[model samples]
Target: MVHEPRSQTGLSRNSDTEEIVALAELDPESWSAILAPRLAYFAAVARAEHVTRAAHQLQAPQSTVSRALVRLERDLGVDLFARHGRTVSLTAAGRTFLATVERALGEVERAAESVRADADPESGKVAFGFLHTMGSETVPSLIREFRADHPRVRFTLVQNYGEWMLEHLRSGELDLCLTSPVPDAPDLVARRLDEQRLRLVVPEDHRLATRKRIRLAEAADETFIMLEPGYGLRRITDDLCAEAGFRPRIAFEGEEAETLRGLVAVGLGVALLPPPAVPRKGVVELTVTGQRAVREIGVAWLKDHPDTPPVAAFKRFLLTRKGRLLSFSPAGV
Candidate 1:
């Protein structure tokens, strides 16, 4: 003989309700066992691949790393890497698992930092990450002002490319970053600091260098000196060239805007660049026809850090000088 159990919402409480609550609190052992070891292993793998330069970054012996990785694989009940010669590459499962681990660890770190920040708002160290190009201009000024205003604040600044900096910012490794506007991340809040138009930097004797309004296609055959791919300027230049129905003939690849400009000055190749405040002595700046490539550069930080004193003061300075900064934009700007 069997009886129907009453639902929790029904008049009487059932034995099943207490059992369900107990299971919710303690019975998910299999899921927990799978997740914790996997995340810890994923962190080791991420440090091995993404953050470190050499195969062993922390002075750990190569055998130690290999043994640790093997232990992780054993604990996870699957292989996470495939080795070819001296190199180790992630397996498909490894890639998928790594993303989840990175995200979870990031959230944990942010939550921990939030508690620490709440406790000591003014005394802890702060890091400012800046894009390489912008760091040449805006960073020095801001750093000087910040150091003067907050003598007690410990500060560290890193110069890196845009995409890499964005990843570090999202991970809470960076307190704030100065970079051009990227497609906004949900957790990010950007305050516009300045805007500038792109200009053509070419050798002084080049034909297009003399023109006030030359079409993009006109320079299509010219050797283009560009930053390596993954750079924001390279992406913009490639898009602009594609839109103009041609591709650029890249002759030299560089990482620095000023270096790219210097290459153009020395007859290496022409480059499309944002009008930076630094002057290139022999390079000519030309106006592109029907195009004023513009980008807005700004300060970005986690939205929850709105009242951070240094962040607030930096925003105030940028906003106050934004008008004067506009004047430094390219000629057409």
Candidate 2:
């Protein structure tokens, strides 16, 4: 697109026309072919501060490095360096341009590494991230079951909270993740594997220990042991308490669900938690009656990412286990 400069009378200037024509002739691809190698040359020269030493470091001739830098300055319309005898120093413009060039080089290197990693189908790796709660049982079971088929497939597992895990998924650090209260994002492909019911656990000798089923509001006055603020369980706890028409009085906050269970076992405070795979001693699990007392666990991956062999296999294995959730799953969510 060309914009002809116009005066108040709408007459075009000849000087502006010539400038636009010259600008139009500057093809970006051709210029980049000329600029890319020069950027490397500039970086080397900036580092060494001496043309001869910079050329030696790059294993190139001194004349070649010097000529490239001169042409680069001409093309960019900036004074990149000031030479005093054999020593060189970067101009203000040179420092700013080097910062951008370094970032561009890093991105290129990462792209190349990713492409090479993707090309290897044999003995490939899957970066599988998941929730801390699922790491103990659900995740392990899924991996073991999946690996039975693809024995050579490797895994890099990460355990993190709900939204945090999704960040890893988007960045391509994780091929897939299992998270609770599945995150809603336009860029993510999420499938609800199943919903696992969370039970209200109390110490064996507590007043509500004998009750197999109870309403959440019934224990409004009790001090609740909750996961810290960012956790998916904590969000569910707050929502469930809100549904019950009261805010829980938090007695303790911790990172892991098992730690919260431990706190409950000693009578420190009662907690609303997922039923442990093997019920921890000294704590009794009870069903919460009103509203749903379940968290929806699901797998998520970036919609734009091309799945590797291991990632695709693992994902298919997970989908097959849709209705077959963990051992503690109740009749309904």
Candidate 3:
């Protein structure tokens, strides 16, 4: 007969010791595949210290529980329980293993509960995105109206310009977005919710300030402050200027409309912009006449994306508000 090596503790370094060493070296995925399903069974038996009692607690047959425990011990290559008459006590290895098992089970339970809470119909979360211009009033009004009926629904709101929000929608970061010029793309579903007439904003003392309406061509020679390129408003402004027969002389490129309005207020330059939520003191907003000087505001989402209950409900509400989405009138309109 071949004899295996023995440790100083007099325990033989046999196949069990080899197996235990191999298990300890396993990668997380391999360890999970081997031990995950058996962890609950081992924990229950360890807790009750009685196989029959543990089986009853687990609502499983005693024989099945016994077989599972035996297989678990065999797979682990360690005797976890010291068996007595109809009862048991944990070996040193079982006690050490139980601590980590309990924590893992707790983390798994918490993760499951978190997802359940997010999926709850009455109180789920919606990842909503919109333009910076809408943040001050339009979005707040919409959310307030929505919450009056769905008091428990939650929203994760993002404010950015159009194309950025559209990218977020495509990447699954956003559930839905309100954008302008109404994106025409194969991967997106877009709807024109409303149209906001663009206005020519000028300093109070500028030549065109007193005019109620003017042809866009009249501003051909004037310096313009525009939203930086890649912004939806910037694209719309460029298109409108092109139709009016001249490329604008851009003096400053900015991110926010309010900032551009501030520049216009100080006589830096004129701008083609949407109506401010609150009219500024030093800028006169005139209607742009003769051409289609309006931006079509729309809601967009991924064509194939499936929405959670709260997201779906909010989308339905948005669709119902078509043509009336931007109900508030701009200054001087």
Candidate 4:
């Protein structure tokens, strides 16, 4: 089938106006050279229809604008404008090209604007990790309030435990973290948020459940249901028992706080836990003494990266909000 190029000027309209055209397809590199540079210039020239006027607006010489048009025509292998006396006018092709050029420029501007906003502290994605204890009580409220203030920024929460969180924070896999204080590692900066006591979780009906507080020495002989090894809570529980001069008898081990609480609820055994938050429906909290057992829940990140614009903004938000809730870190200049 024979096909002819469509004309943009009304003067060139014919029966072949709807024919398939090769000028419609352009390679990426060719498109960059022909359509990217001086695109605004083309729109300006197309609008004014005068070389000197377009040149004045572009802050370029008339010849420079003419040369850019020549390059564009060469790239497309078609005449875009026609020379009429000393002025130029759009050819059939120039009119079609102008529409596409204007649309593309608008899209590019929108993309640039989005990138700028995401790079700003007030807007972006904040990837963070936190411990389950804080996840239940503190982190959720912090996130809700932060979102309310800065709706453009997004928060992604990762639930993690122990030193694995520290590893992820330092390696850049995590942007920020909330965890109980671990042994200080070089280059890892932390803000101690609050101290929470480790309490014995047992069913409300259990014999020792009536006690407000008991020495860790008293529970040394009881079988303890605990989180698996490596959780910060488990380590604290194990360390407290060791400090009391006996290892806890492990009846069962699990991961979720609710599960461990449930095991304790059934009178299976008591488990050492962070200070109770939800009340566990039927569980009771017994404070332990002697060990003076408490863990510092803090916001931790790599020292160097903590000061980055987005990270710093989030740190400030967390610190300010945390201070109002329960003072956590020492503020330093």
- The CA lDDT of each predicted structure is 0.67, 0.82, 0.87, 0.74
For residues 205-265, what per-residue lDDT tens digits would candidate 2 score against the true structure?
9999999999999999999999999898899989999999999998899999999999999
lDDT of 4 at 266: 85
Per-residue C-alpha lDDT of model 1 across residues 1-333, encoded as one tens digit per residue: 765543221212233556445445654565555356446544665556521233245555544444446545544557676654445567887787778878888888899997576335455456778777766556676656656766665567898877777788778888777776553778887777676677778898887766776777788889999989987778888988898889899999998888898889899889888876566688888777766566667777776754466555555655666535445333324
Clash counts for the predictions, in order: 0, 0, 0, 3
Worst 10 residues of 2 by lDDT: 6-15
- lDDT, candidate 3, at 204: 99
Clashes of 3: 0
**Most lDDT-accurate candidate:** 3
**lDDT of candidate 4 over 248-267, digit per residue (tens):** 89999998777898888888
* Regions more than 4 Å wrong, model 3: 1-38, 50-52, 60-97, 329-333
| Model 2 residue 272 CA deviation in Å | 0.5
Q: Against the true structure, what is every candidate's RMSD?
A: 16.4, 10.0, 5.5, 9.8
TM-score (all chains, Cα) for each model? 0.58, 0.67, 0.80, 0.62
Q: Please provide, for model 3 over 9-120, each residue's C-alpha lDDT reduced to its tens digit, 9 standing for 90 to 100.
A: 2323344666667877888578677778878888998999888888899999876677667657767778887877678888999899899989998898899998788777
